[model samples]
Target: MNNRDQKGFNANDNSNFNIGKVVQNFASPETRNNSETKLLNAVKNEVALRLAQSLHRRVYVELDKTEDPSQVASPWSMDVKLGDSPSQECPEGTHIVTIFDKKEIGGRLLILGAPGSGKTTLLLQLAEELVQRAEANAKAPVPVLLNLSAWKTQYSDIRSWMVVDLKQKYGVRKDIAEDWIETERILPLLDGLDELMSQRQETCVQALNDFLPDWTGTPLVVCSRFEEYQVYESNLGLNGSVIVQPLTDEQIETYLCRAKCDWLWEAICPDRDIMNPETGLARSPLFLSMLVLASDKLPPELWRQDKSAKERRRILFEAYINARLSCPYRGGENYQVGSKKSDRRQSKRKPVRNPYPKDERTKRWLGWFAARSVEDAQTELFIEKLQPYFLKTRPQEFVYGLVYGLVLGLVLGLVLGLVYGLVVGLFVGLVGEKSSNTVETIKISWRSTPRNFYKGIQTYIVYGLVIGLVYGLVIGLVVGLVIGLVIGLVIGLVVGLVLGLIGEEIDTKISDNQGIYQSVTNSIICGIVFIPFGVLILTALHYFHEPMQLSEILAQGAVKGFLLGASAGGLLSAIEHSALRITLWLFGYAPWNYSKFLRYCTDRGFLQRVGGGYRFVHALLRDHFAEHYDPS
Candidate 1:
């Protein structure tokens, strides 16, 4: 064949190959649509399950004793008006879910209400309905409830925050959350716009506006307090808005009667004067719930007494808290909200914790915790994060720490001195002798600074106290204390001294501008080299003293020493870096356990458990505690 024909034939073959590759990778319109539908359905099911669980989790069976069993779970509803005539979608009073689901409403609605006026309850109800609809319709968007109190507008936009919220609250995979968000397959039922800082509220609203148009293809709803949202001169420009109406006196009377709380109904509205403004306190669902629970305990005439509304309300709430605390309550009920009659009422999960033991200690801890929550502007409080609030933050407190550390060390040294002192002293003597004779000075690194050495001492003391306490509890206090003290002192002194000696300035020739990773590697190597040798030396010295197999002694001692060294070394490295030290101090290794107390508060009505954390059942309750609590 001619050269030109051969070249043309080769080019043609390459072109055909490229086209075939494109065809293989490309998806047809139907295929893309089907794939999208499947992903949406999976998300819908996951969301439905979560919403149902959250909705039914808090069934006050005991509290419901006064009410009809059938109506226990029924949330109260009111007719809601949305916007003015022409552009108005939901002119007739409509529910939250209906406004969000109706195509004509375009799924963009704002719910504004007073504190504890049932905004959250309404949102939850909306979520429950959407969840059910999602199950029935494959094309429906999954509704996800998001708490906006944690949103930081300066750092992240609304869309980004939603992604994080999903992953955190629901344990949704980040990729899946992002995909769901990007595809607009998930509906965001945002709660607590008023929860954001007042100053940043405008910026948050603006960010919401910017984020909504292109990102979420489906409709979304936002909730805020009526007065808080009114602070701004302009509206949020949402499709429609509804103001949560105050409960009518008749409604309150009827509700109380239905709940079989005739006593409270008469107390608040004597002579069946339901419209009397004197019973204005019942307008809030929170206050009404409190009255329902506390009516039996409170004087029937307390509501009619000369006490001001504020004082009466305070007394009612205090009584309510006490009632919940005293009751033999279990956790919330967990049943599918929109299932068949037979299966709908099925209880799935038990209360998160057992009924709280009624006690003063629990109340005190909850009061302190509530105060901290208000200060931090955090509604959700995780148990692990509770340590920081209990931490002694005043700079003057370290003086106490130092004295405490010294006493601890001295006590530990005396106890452990019986066994480890001689061995450790002997090892130190040998090390000291070897160094004195050799030209090789003991090298120092950042991990061995005097400050860190002091810190290590403190850490060891705490560890010893914890171990000693545990042991003391398990065995007799005196014996357990002695044993734990010895173990803690031995580990702490051995590890602390080693780290302190090594933490000083090293010769320039040895450093080689070592980076953190390299330093860590070197520290690990040092631990691997020295720990076993030290352990072996100690074991040999004690071999005749303690009747044990030498090999077994060496093996166990070596393993323990190596672990101690590695832990000390890593801690030393963290201490050397300022940022890392602060981070560790603040988060990873803070020193208190308020878990038991937190659990107690959560089991009762004072707090609500949410994923790995606790939140005050309502913000108003938190404020009440914060203002009224005087722990001093």
Candidate 2:
């Protein structure tokens, strides 16, 4: 067959890949086109920024043909064209992009490497190039970097999961995300397959295999640790596989020299123990980079110590943490230590200060976070997603729930009454016991005509009636039954109508500061909407109920309405999350302001921001912290 046939498509051909054509026939073509352009630009910007953060200086690692592609790739000829082979061998130390372009591989590539061998870095490098290409050519597929570790068994289909990832990670609307997938405009670069549990790894491999048939012409790339991937019974259905090569001694020396780390190079070059094959510390780019960062703080004699690879790694990480913490801070003032105004005459640059919580406390908090993240099998940590499970002991959990419920109840009671407070408290306490495993972004938008307006009214009216009935029973025991029933019906109808008019739509998307702001705004709106209704109800009730003054009734009604409204909205959830966070802080597991702490860690090079969450700079670092975690 000709090269064009073998490769599945000509490099110059744009007919099959034109994204504009894909959405041209859809309704509101202009809107779709704009959304698509925005999505691609956002992806490019995010990928470029991530690449810059992970690798401060661009360092290309070499990739080579796997010794046995047949071992990891599907053997079934029907799944992939195994018979068709490349006319010439891919030379040693070939760039990943070049290998991806070859006819035989046809864009379906799998990358494998040993731990700390730069598998993720290589994948990001590939994504950077692909994103550039996509930006230049609309016909080219948009490259999206995702973590397979986040995949769950619930999503039996891989495409469905990708849709969710795009929506959550990139903030793409659900319909648009689905359209992008259906049109095959996305080039998925899935990383961290080995990060999944062993059993799930096999299942993910099978899922990828099943997903390939439907996505026959589209490109796909997956990364994993060679040792873990090789043991899996199932093989990925891909055109080809390549393993990331370890850094040669010469390459290591060149990198160190370029980094101006002559002392590190000198220490590593002469030491047989440090560069030994078993330890292979200098051979891995990640370790070498860590060594460079930690070199100044790391004592010279520590490198020559006789130690196992694991112990050596532990010591290296300790030094690395110290070095990062000790270094001058970089990035924007997202989490500044103090509010010091910058002088216009002093170059408008605030002087750098030491990071908060000190080095020892920072390490302990990170260790705790890493341990819990591993236990949950989570690669990304979201501030709002912190659960009761983060609390180590049962007593802690109980205290968190009780405090959370009690706080809400007391606030509501002070404003509304004892009955309202007790009911809200009981409800909130029950909800606190339930786990918050799902993370999502809720949006409240107004529609000209809500989809189920009548249904919503009916549902909310029922809720209002139930609450009103309880209030009526409580009031009736003290006051007359007629007065209680009349007041209850009016209050219930007004509250129900108000709620029914404002319909809320919850969308599952990733959010950070923006999400919190949105929730706060929602709470405020809910409080405002209920205040007037409350004032009118209380003013009318004063005639037949207790003989109260007009000003006193209005004051009491307004306060009660606002509190009840806020609590009924998202105020309860916000308070509950705070309770959980404070509980963790009391146990010294995390700081009070998690977002700031995480941002500080990102500034310190221990973590990197991914979408609305944070992930360790490398899985190896996460593993190190998890293994060495000391709760006490």
Candidate 3:
């Protein structure tokens, strides 16, 4: 086939090449390459819209078979309105002409929607109906629905994919004939084709043409992002489309009343909270399902929680994740409105993975898959995403950071304090020395004079302290205490922290950590070294005209510093203690663990990790928070 014939999708050619008995044998590089190029060019637009329109006809239902014990839904008679949310068939517009009939849809249908559109829920509901109908029929054949992402080849023939996927979905021991299955017109729905990562549009289209054909006309539905379809649809040559639109509150209300699920929204009730008289389900089908599931699973009496209107909406949304986890929680409930209890659930073989590997030549070939994953460990999950987070892990290194920072500040503070103290002290001493008649001790001994008594005492104290400095004890013990505490308290204060960071910056220029450490030492060392300044100040005061004794002034300083230092230490100590306690309590896990996670945060949270302690506590204490920590 030349480019012109290849221009349109060719399902026959691809079928001949891929036809083989062993599933493993058919999985080859050549076939994969050929298939991807064809699929990339396969028909788009109307194909997606048409499918979406078809699938939209089914009634929405619960994903889980068992009730999520934590959820609180509305009363049985209460008709919870879907309020503004999209429904199956009618998105935002009035009814239009039918493009296809039930006969065309048969037991299978597909609908492709944009990310925000309600494709998945609509598809699931349809799948449920098809499964039910097939089960009810004695002559019914197997009908399977699979996500296209599970497929390995980007350009894969849909028919071959069907046989293989059905084998996996049904645990078929023997391979089924592709022609035989097609002749009977059995259709298996596949969703999310835009999610496939192959760059070769031509190959993907060819794969589809060879795989899906008009002869059988089995309904195949797929959703594509609008942008993706525009770029890749030339080769497929297909049309008929439906676009999902935003729904009004009235629409949501109408759907919800019709849905008659375990949820309802109105002004208020004992079971459901008073939703914004205006707020309704709208925008997407996914969101509608989230609200229904959360409302149904959570206890009805509790659905009207203390959350802000926005917060309640967010809480309502957390059910999607519950829906996602429904796979593991299957029990004995039927989500389909008309489903019979006697109709047993089918468990398929292990799920299949259809990987579409990218080759290096195309611009998006090799790494495109990574780009599309959209969410992962580092990916931030918002309320919309339905992923939970544990907050306790955040402050894990708090103590290590705070203490290491403080110790360094102490050494630097000491050095700076010495220089500033010595310089200031000496200047005061020199100024006082200039004022004094002689530098030694400012006192004039007078015989029989009351004033002389004070002078004599002042001189004695100054002289005594000088001698103490020269000897073993510098300044009297009182002098030392006075100066030390004052210096210690100030050094430990917030000013020290600012200075330390500044010191670090200067260190960057000079690469001098010793200088940084020296400054920290000085902040604390200032208290010790500056004690002398305190004594000198007392001595200088004595030289002045109305001087007090040097000893009295020194005593005052020592007392203040000691008291201040003790208070400061206690504060810093408390900070450290609180940090550790909170870090353990809130983040990942610690003494308390996250015991309340499944219980406290159940429907209201998308908690991935433990609620971090402080943030978690804040959330708990927030006005709407209903529970308190027991710590029992």
**lDDT of all predictions, in order shown?**
0.53, 0.67, 0.34
Report the lDDT of model 2 for residue 523: 71
Quick one: ranking by TM-score, best first?
2, 1, 3
Please identify model 1 stretches exceeding 4 Å from their true place.
1-60, 63-83, 86-95, 135-140, 171-177, 270-279, 299-306, 328-358, 387-596, 630-632
User: Lowest summed-lDDT stretch of 10 residues in model 2?
Assistant: 71-80
Per residue, candidate 3 scores C-alpha lDDT tens digits across 168-220 of 32322122335336443243555556645556433554565555444233344
Best by TM-score: 2
Worst 10 residues of 1 by lDDT: 432-441
lDDT of 2 by residue, 1-632 (tens): 23222222233234223334434423232232555676666666656546555633212110111222121111001011232443233454456798777665667777877787777767877888888877666667678877888888898788888877776566666666777788777789999899998878888887887887666556788888878876766567666666666666777776676566767788778777678754578877778877877777886546755777777777888888888788665433353221112212122445466557387788888998888778767777777777776676777877787777778778878765778986787677646464542312333334424656677678878887877877877776766777676667766776676676654232322346555555566777778777886776677578766677878888888887787677666676677777777788888888887777887887677887765677888888998888776473
TM-score list, all predictions:
0.58, 0.77, 0.32
What candidate 2 gets wrong by more than 4 Å, as runs, is 1-38, 55-95, 133-141, 171-176, 270-273, 276-279, 300-305, 328-351, 415-512, 535-557, 630-632
Best by lDDT: 2
Tell me how many clashing residue pairs each candidate has. 4, 0, 107
